[model samples]
Target: MTQTVMHLDDTDSLERFDAALDALEGHLKRVFADDSAEADRAVLAALQEQVRVLTEERDRLLTDLEAERARVQRLKEANEEVSGRLEGVMGALKDMAPALQD
Candidate 1:
């Protein structure tokens, strides 16, 4: 059976992940309920492999999320520094405004 791959890159990723897990669990239950022992064993092995792959994907996504969060923090700090310097420059310009007017 061909399985569909879902990318978990958005805000609803957790929900999608849960749904995928549930689907896998349902399939496992159906396999156990089946009377064909050999076929069920094969299906079970395949399902186990899919679970392993999904777990690895989840770990990779978590690592990516951490890196993205760090990047955002760095950007925020840089933006604040730039904003402060711009405010200081504007204040200096205001101080020179009266002299220029006179």
Candidate 2:
């Protein structure tokens, strides 16, 4: 026996619910026959697996990029510190050289 919902509208909330139920029922029926069921299951499983892998890869890349940015910031700070020290040393050298000449 086929079960059907009447007045199916994709726009209305009730229609959406009915459509979803109908789709599930069809998927189940297709799943019953060996060839149809197996093919549908395989396609769905493959799609879900691919989505999972891509999600993980995206998350990993985001983490790596953030780490790289942080490292760059730290190096910048270190470079600034070195620059300040060099300027101070140059100033001292200038002062000592003038006194030695006098």
- Ten-residue stretch with the least lDDT total in model 2: 5-14
lDDT of 1 by residue, 31-84 (tens): 778777556477688887887788788778778768877887999999999999
Q: List pairs with backbone clashes in candidate 2.
A: none
What C-alpha lDDT values do all the predictions have?
A: 0.80, 0.66
Tell how far residue 41 is off in model 1, in angstroms: 1.9
- Superposed on all Cα atoms, model 1 deviates from the true structure by an RMSD in Å of 7.0
Runs of candidate 1 exceeding 4 Å displacement: 1-11, 22-38
Instruction: Using lDDT, give the best candidate's number.
Output: 1
Q: Given candidate 2, what's the lDDT at residue 89? A: 100
Clashing pairs in 1: none
Clashes of 2: 0
